[model samples]
Target: MDNVSSVIEFTLSGFDEILDYKLTFFCLTLLCYCVIIMVNVVVVVTIAMDRNLYEPMYIFICNLCINGLFGTAGFYPKFLLDLLSHHWGISYTGCLLQGLVIYTSVCSDICFLAVMAYDRLMAICRPLEHSSVMTRQRVAQLVCFSWLAPLGLLSASTIFTSRLKLCGSNIKKLYCANWMVAKLSCAATNWVTSTTPGNVIAYVIILFYIFLGVFIFCSYVQLTRCCFKSLANRGKFMKTCVPHLLALFNISIASLFDAMYMRYGSSDFPQSFQNLLALEIIIGPPLFNPLIYGLTLSQIRNQVLHKYLQNK
Candidate 1:
C-alpha cells in the first residue's frame, strides 16, 4: 500500500478516437440526446394526461419511458461534455455514481419489461383474474419493487467499488462500469471472487435473465393457445404482443452486446467496434421503445399524434 498510488480520477479514453471529430460528434450527440428526451417525455406525458389511458398497461409504459430518460441522464450529459472538452476525466466519486445510475437503469429496464410481460400474460392467459390480480395498488407496489430492488443491490456493489484501492487511472469505457473499475483495483485478482459483491451481482443477474426468459416463453406459449381459441384474442396479440416482443428483442440484443464487450473486450478489437458495443445498449432501447410502442399501440399513437398536430 505504501508503494502504490490510488486513482483519484478516471480518464475516459473511450472518446479519444471519435474526439478527432469532436465538433461533429458533439452536435450529433446533442441532437440524439434531445430527441431521446422529447420522445420519451411525450409518451410519459401523454399517458399521464389522458384519463382513458389510466390502465395497467399504459401506466407500465409510462414507467418504461421514465426509466429510459433516467438511464440516459447518467450518460448523455457527461458524454456531451467529454465530446466538447479537452479533458474527459471524472472524479472517483463521480464515476461510482455514474456507474450506479447506468447499471441500475439498464437492469431496471429488464425489471420493467418483466413486469410488462407479466401484465400481458395475465391479460391474455388469465383474463378473468387479470383485473382482480393487477389492481392499481398492486401495480404501484410492483413498480416500486422493480425500481428499488436494483437500486438497493447496486448501491451495495458501488460501495465495494469505492473501497477498492485502484492502481490505474484510465478506464477505456465511455462511462464507468462496475467491472472496469473493479479490474483497476489493487486486488484485481480477487475483485471478482464469490465473496465480492460484484461477483454476486453477476451471478444474480444471470439467474434473473434465465428466469425471465423462461417466464416470458411460457407466457407466450399460453398466449398463443388463447389466441388460437378466438379471433379477438389473436387480433389483440398481433397489436399488443408484437411491440412488446420487439422491445424485448431490442433490449436483449443490446444488453448481450454490452455484456460481451464489457467482460471480454480489449484494445485488440477496433476502437470503432468497441465504441459501437458500448453505445448500442445505451442508445438502442431508449430510442427504440417510444417509437415502437407509440406507433404500434393505437390509443397511444393517436393521442401522441393528436397532441403533436394540435401544437403545430
Candidate 2:
C-alpha cells in the first residue's frame, strides 16, 4: 500500500532479456513500420483517388488501412524508442493514452471486419437489395459507427482504469494495456474489490467481443449458404468476400494469440516466444491486411500496378 502513492510511472520489463539483440531488433522494427506505412498509404491513396473504386467494399478497406496506420502509430514509435533506450518507462498518463489508442484501434478493426462481413452478406444473400441497403449515405453511417462504437467503449474502459489506485509500477509487457494497468491496482483497495469498476469494464469488453464474434459468425454462415446456392453467388464470394475473410482470419488468430497468452501465459515460456506473442497482434495484421488485399483484389492490384508502370 505504501508504494501506491509514489508510483507515477511503469517500468516495462519485456525488453530486459532482449538487450543483446536490441540493435538488430530496432532495425527490423523500423523497416517493418516503414513498410506498414507505405503499403497502407498506397492502398488508401489509390482507393481515395480513383472514383471508380468508390464502392462500399473499397470504402471499408480504405478505412481498415487508415486504422492500421492509426493503431501502429500508437505503438511503433514508442517501441522503437524503447529499443534504443536503456530503460523502458512510461508516465501514467502516457500509458493510459497508449492503451486507449491501441485498444480502440483494435476494437475498430474487428468492428470494421464485422461490418464488412455484413456488407458482403447483403451483397451475396440479398443482391437485389444490396444497392438499396448499402447506399453511400448508409455506408458513411456504418463507417462512423465502426469508429465511434469502439472509441466510446474503450474510452469508458480507460477512464475506469485511470480511476484505479495502482500499487505497482511494473508492467510485464513492452506496451501498456488496459488489463495490465488494471492488474496493478492494490488488491485490498475499493477499486479492485469484487465488482469493482475495472472488473465491470473488463467484463463489458469481453461481452462485446463475444457479441461481435457471434454476429460475424452468423453473418458468414448465411453468406456461405447463399454462395453455395448458385455459381454466380460463388463467384462473388470468391472475388470480394475471400479477401475480407482472409484478413478477418489473419487478425483474429493474431489477436487471439495475444489475448490467450496474456491471460494464461506461463513464466516458464522463453522470453523471446513471449515477446513474439505479445507483438503478433500489432505486427501481423497491419502488415498482412494491405498485402493480402493488394494482391487478391483485382481492382486494387491493377490500379496499383498501372500507377507503378506509369511512374516507371
Candidate 3:
C-alpha cells in the first residue's frame, strides 16, 4: 500500500468460486430476481388499485414490497453482470452508494416490521381506538421513520468508512460492506482504535435491532394475551398476526445469518458456501416476504385471485 489513499476500486471475489458454473448460477439467480419482481409488483398493484385494501396494514405491506424492490435492485443487477463479464469490481463511490442502498433497505425493513407489529398490537389490544390512533398522519410518520432512520444512520456510517486510509482493495464476499471496507485500514490505523467512528455507530445499530426485536416480542406477547380472551381476537391473530410472525421469523433468520457471518466469517470455509451466506440476507427475504403477505392477507388474496390469478 505505497499510496493507500489512491485505492479507487474494490474487487469482489464472491463470484470466483462459481466461475465454472456461471451459466447455472446466472439462470437460477435471474429466475429468482424475476419472481421477486413479479410477485412484489402484483401485490403492490393489488393493494394500490383496490381502495378497500387501503387500511394501515395494506399500506405498510405496500411499503414493504417497494423496499424489497429497493434492496434487491442494489445487488442483483451488478451481480448478474459480474457473472457474465470478466471484471468483478465496483468503484469506491459506487461501493458506498451500493452499501447505502442495501443497508438502508435492510434496516428500514425492520422499521416497517416494527411499525406493523405496533399496528397489529393496537388493532387487537385496543380495537375501539385502533382507527383513531392510526390516523393518516400517524401512518405517514411511521412510514417516514422506517425510511429516514436507516438513511440517517447509515449515511453517518458511510462517512466514517469513506475517511479511512484503506490498505486493501479486495472484498472477499459479494457487495460492499462498510465494516469490511473499514477492516481494510492502513497499518497506521488500528482496527479498533479509540478514534474509530464505526465502533460507536456499530453498537448503535446493534442496539437499534435489539430494541426493535424486544418491542416486537413484547407486542406479540400482549397480542397473545388478548387472543385467549375472545374468539374474535383469536381469529384476528390467526389472520393477521400469524403471517407477520412468520415473516419476522424469516427475516430474523436471514439477518442473523448475515450478521453472524459478517462478524465471524472464516477463510477456511469454501468460497461458494461463503457466498451463499453473504447472499442470505438480501436474496431470500425480498422474494419470499411479499408472497407471505399476499397469500395470507385475505383482502389481498381475494383481489389477486379474482383478478390475474383466477381461471382464464
Steric collisions counted per model: 0, 0, 0
Clashes of 3: 0
Determine the C-alpha RMSD for candidate 1 after optimal superposition of all C-alphas. 2.1
In candidate 2, which residue pairs get closer than 3 Å at backbone N, Cα or C atoms, i.e. clash?
none
Candidate 2 local lDDT, 4-109, one digit each (tens)? 3356899998888799999999999999999999999999999999999999999999999999999999999999999999989999989989989987888888
lDDT of the candidates, in the order given: 0.86, 0.88, 0.88
lDDT of 3 at 74: 94
In candidate 2, what residue range of length 10 has the lowest lDDT sum? 187-196
The CA-based lDDT of model 3 is what?
A: 0.88
Sort the candidates on lDDT, descending order: 2, 3, 1
TM-score of each: 0.94, 0.95, 0.96
Residue-wise C-alpha lDDT for candidate 1, range 4-58, written one tens digit per residue: 3367789988877886788998888899999999999999999999999999888
Looking at model 3, the pairs that clash are none
Q: Write the per-residue lDDT of candidate 3 for residues 1-312, one digit (tens) a residue.
A: 343357799999776888899999899999999999999999999999999988999999999999999999999999899999989999999898999999898898899999999999999999999999999999999999999998999998888778777778988888988877877778435567733576788789889889999999999999999999999999999999988998898888888888777866645877777877888988877988899998888889889989965655
Segments in model 1 whose C-alpha atoms lie over 4 Å from true places: 1-5, 192-197
Best by TM-score: 3
